[model samples]
Target: MTLKELLGIFERQGIKRIDPMGQKFDHNLHQAVAQIETPDAAAGTVVQVLQAGYTIHDRLLRPAMVGVAAGVMQQVNTSA
Candidate 1:
């Protein structure tokens, strides 16, 4: 699911969604997980949580999807 969809889940659950990356949530996710150690990662699963202590206690909509060292998985080509 898309990041927006995840946020929707939180909204439905009466929870507040926090976007660390601000308006650029996707870009923020990429920046947050970059250069982090994620051993035994899957093909499209590299968004490893570095630390959770910093997170405020609240209902999470869902974890963000992050690309590996390369980049995110784009379903459609943006070069049009």
Candidate 2:
């Protein structure tokens, strides 16, 4: 009846949600929509999830749309 109940039914039917937050980026499970430069998290880590992903019985139904963390670029001094 409610959304939570529906989700529970889906879960009972072997549907699982993929949570990518704070996890390492995986091409198979996550689709990187954007890359953000930050020093807070390691590069190639999933920083945000734009869309949730799902799987059924170990088969992926959809990949999670996410934003991956990129290492901050440092300026190189060329002046001698």
- Give me the displacement of residue 2 in model 2, in angstroms: 3.0
What's each prediction's TM-score?
0.24, 0.91
User: Best candidate, TM-score-wise?
Assistant: 2
Q: Model 1: how large is the Cα RMSD against the reference?
A: 13.4
lDDT of prediction 1: 0.42
**TM-score of candidate 2 against the unseen true structure:** 0.91
Candidate 1 structure quality by residue, lDDT tens digits, 1-80:
99789767756766564433212324333334553333444333444434321122453435444334333345787796
lDDT of model 1 at position 61: 34
**Clash count, one per candidate:** 0, 0
Name the lDDT value of residue 34 in candidate 1. Answer: 53
Q: For model 1, give the 10-residue run with minimal summed lDDT.
A: 47-56
